[model samples]
Target: MMAPATTSRPTSATAPSTFTSSCTRRTDGVTMCAWRDSGTRIVPTSSTSTRCRNPATPTRRTSRSVNSATRRSSRRGSPPRSIPCVRCRIRNRRKSPPGRSARTRSRCRRVLSARRCACGIDRIRSWLTRTRCCFMRRCWRSCSLVLIAFVLAACPTKTEGGGGDGSFEVQDPLTRRLMDPDATTDERIDRVLAEAKPGNTAALPALLRVMRHRSQAAFLVVSDGKARFGYRTVELRETQKDTRSMERVAAIVALEAINSPVALPDLVLALDDVNEVVQNHAARALVRLGNRAGIPTLIANLDNRILQRETANRLLEEISGKQGFIADAGWAERQKGLAAWQEWWAGIQASDERLPIEGRAYQIGADAEADRRIGFFVDVVGQYQFLFHEQARKALIRIGEPALPFLREGVERARKDDNATTRAGIAQILETIDHPNGRELLRDLLTDASGSVRARAAEAFGNLAGKGAIAALQGVLGDRDPGVPIAALDGLGRIGGADALAVIRRYVPGEDSALQEAHILATFAASRGREQRDRTLAMLLGVSIATRNAAHAVLVRITGDDAGYDSLATESARKEAMERYRGLLGG
Candidate 1:
């Protein structure tokens, strides 16, 4: 019959009879035969990849049939085995014409670039070539599967905000530093705070991690160092400043700086942080955010230790605008109040109504309308975003003396609150109120028992009372709190008189802490036309960089020139700059 069509198929001796080189309109989606392996070609295949290729010219015995051996072997009931799948079309890849699918193009990249995939494919080929067809039909399949399992297991998984408990990337370097044990990094924290804009929630995950973390670095500590997990007396460094208990406090500060509603849930939940200091910070953040969700937690803390009870009542007063809760009352005294606080919180919750609260740091008063305006502005001033705090301060000043009674009341109430930032914010409103009503109250606040309150009030008095408040500020010069004296100096310097300068000159450098001395020296620059401006110049030569920092910053702001004065520079360099500035100054 036409010489039996002169069959062109190769005999078994010439090539493996089971090779599948099918080229019959392959829908494997690959088109070009770019890469080739001689003898037995093995290519790795995965769900996302195909490492095998078909020959360009249809080399199934040159054309009598494609994949002739595979079909033949299958019909003979040879249990199917994975050979180099020649019909698995090789991607045209670089040769692929325009309009090739994105999927095909991407697959082309993965096959060529992924070294592991290429190696795995090469290995599969090696295994197939080493084994006879009979052996490949059985154990080779198992071996290939094990190898693939190993390759896939080595790859890391990609994720996006998955459950929010895993690692994530943030643009700020402070993410790790803020969350880690050595979180005393204020320069990094200030950088992050400067960017804690309304829309920038990138650092929110890291901030939350810090709030939720209660684990402090456990190492040896000196006897007097503050310890959260109780103290164990061990001989450590003699000059250790403070302990690691301040770690979470840094995070709470950053979160408040973020001033975003997105952090509300995390801030509320952080109220239960094992460290009461952290708890107090979280409570203040929630109040400034204007959400009463954490009120129950603070109220629950009322039944806790006296410290927690005092903190709870303090935060509760801010939220509810009521101040009847006595902070130092024993548990027996506060137990009844605890039940009342819980009931009050529950009732507000059930009604789905906003609590009649003043703010995180201020309070409402008998005058509801004025209380509303003051609270509204008070909340705005605490939000640092978009210069909203500055704008709100201007608004409160415009409200004038009529708002003073409530504003003064808010500042007094702010004393018991632990959020110094919020306390300072409320104090700033009083400082610039321009209303004469709060002047005496501002003077009175300078002598309050709380150091922070006294410090805040002292700074406020300079703006509210000016030269008139000098006697009050002088009384505060010998105050026990290191910051109080500095605050008093700042106030007196703002007033700038012979009397104020005389008080400023009384600073005996060794008598106060370095920071206090630094601050006092900085105040001298604020007191212009005084001969003591040279005192600020002298402070620039101090050993403590913090002391120099305060002095340098004030000089720069006042003179509008640094004179190459770098507070962070070497001691000799600082002295040089100080000399240069002295040359710039008269005497």
Candidate 2:
């Protein structure tokens, strides 16, 4: 206002008017907004106003027709005029010239089309920008949030105290609830079993739940001995799904826990459990009872075909020492039981041809398993020959009595085929049969070319204890072979019959080396106790007192002084002893 200010506002008649405000921005850049309804604005009308010129006209922004039309519409007491510039007026007044052709109009259209293309390009760019912005927003909202969080969580962060992944974070409400001491019992039980190590007091709630449920949980806890010793304790009650079997297991376990005599009845009842494990455990528990009262039950179960024979056998062995079964009427009961077993075994043997081997074997006992168990029994007969002499004799007596016909046929076939072992086995079985025909079969064996058969026959005949057997012994005593005569001497002495005394006395004297040798051996077999010692002394006196070199040599032979003859003489004693014992011992 101090001087005439040059105006930035245009004063041209065709210039369009525009109003604008000036704003001053603050240094700290706090923005303020004002609300306005309606207000009157002052237009500058001073006479000393300065005018300015603008090279670009209003027609540059709006067409002349548009400006003119606006002017006409507002002329009826409307608004102030908006003038068109001279270039737009000049363009509006121009007409096509006479030579103007379609090509020229096309050229004009091309310029207009170029302008439209530029506008379209701007709009397309704006739309693409908006679309990209929308896509970025959707990606953040729909997918990236979880993905970013997951990726960030994968890397351990110091802000989270180095916890790696939030996926493994303990955020489950139930899990948190379990940490509280006042949590519900169900939750507490689950937590203790799942999280707490064994022997923790936290196990108490689970133990309580087990008690109330009265189920396998109780059984398991009690079995572990976690519940203290009491009626309410877990171990005291039977809780297995198989109640009958588990009852036995529980009772046995409880008995062991309590270690009382009161467990005896329970253990015995457990023996009747159908479950093999329970039955076996019961058997073991009875052993634990250590009372004589359990012996009868154990002995009774010894023949129980339903029970596992091995377990039963083990139980019998374990408990037999504690229970006075050998002194009790139990032995008699055992004998009856053995007889029953034998009878049952006999039935199995009789049924062997009809039944499966396994079924037959299992039915009798594992020991009597097959036609081949017949072989095992045969082997056992030979193995425990002395210890189970009576049992072997009885069992063989029964087996031989039945198997004789088959063995006889086998023997005949063996003889026809020149099979010595089969024939010998048959003869051996016949000897064990020990019937009237046994002696006759053995006599036939004496004629056999096999020396073993003949020796076996001689021993069997010697053990027969009869006058006919004695006559056979006398004949063998006169034989030249040392084996035959020595065997005869043993047989006659074993028979011990008065009828053979003269023949025995006939061979007692004579210093002929061979005769004296035979006499010394005969005397050793015939005499017993003091008589044996006397006979040995007499032989030594005869040898020592004699002046003959042959007698001295014979004495050296018998006394093991000459190493050359020592082996022979020693072998002779061994043979004589073995054959003689086998005869006296039977089979």
- In lDDT terms, which candidate is top? 1
Write down the TM-score for model 1: 0.36
At residue 75, what lDDT does model 2 achieve? 37
lDDT of 2 by residue, 137-237 (tens): 55546765888889998985432101121112223343334333355555544543453332333333322222222222111111113322211111223
Find the 10 residues in a row with the least total lDDT in model 1.
Answer: 1-10
lDDT of 1 by residue, 43-89 (tens): 22232323333222242223335356545643542312222233332
What's the residue-level lDDT of 215 in candidate 2?
A: 24
> What is the Cα-based lDDT of residue 67 in candidate 1?
55
Error of 2 at 536 (Å): 2.7
Pairs of residues at least 3 apart in sequence or in different chains that clash in candidate 2:
222-235
lDDT of each: 0.54, 0.40
Per-candidate TM-score against the hidden true structure: 0.36, 0.28
Candidate number with greatest TM-score: 1
C-alpha positional error of residue 362 in candidate 2 after TM-score superposition, expressed in Å: 19
Backbone N/Cα/C clashes per model: 0, 1
Alpha-carbon shift of residue 336 in model 1 (angstroms): 72
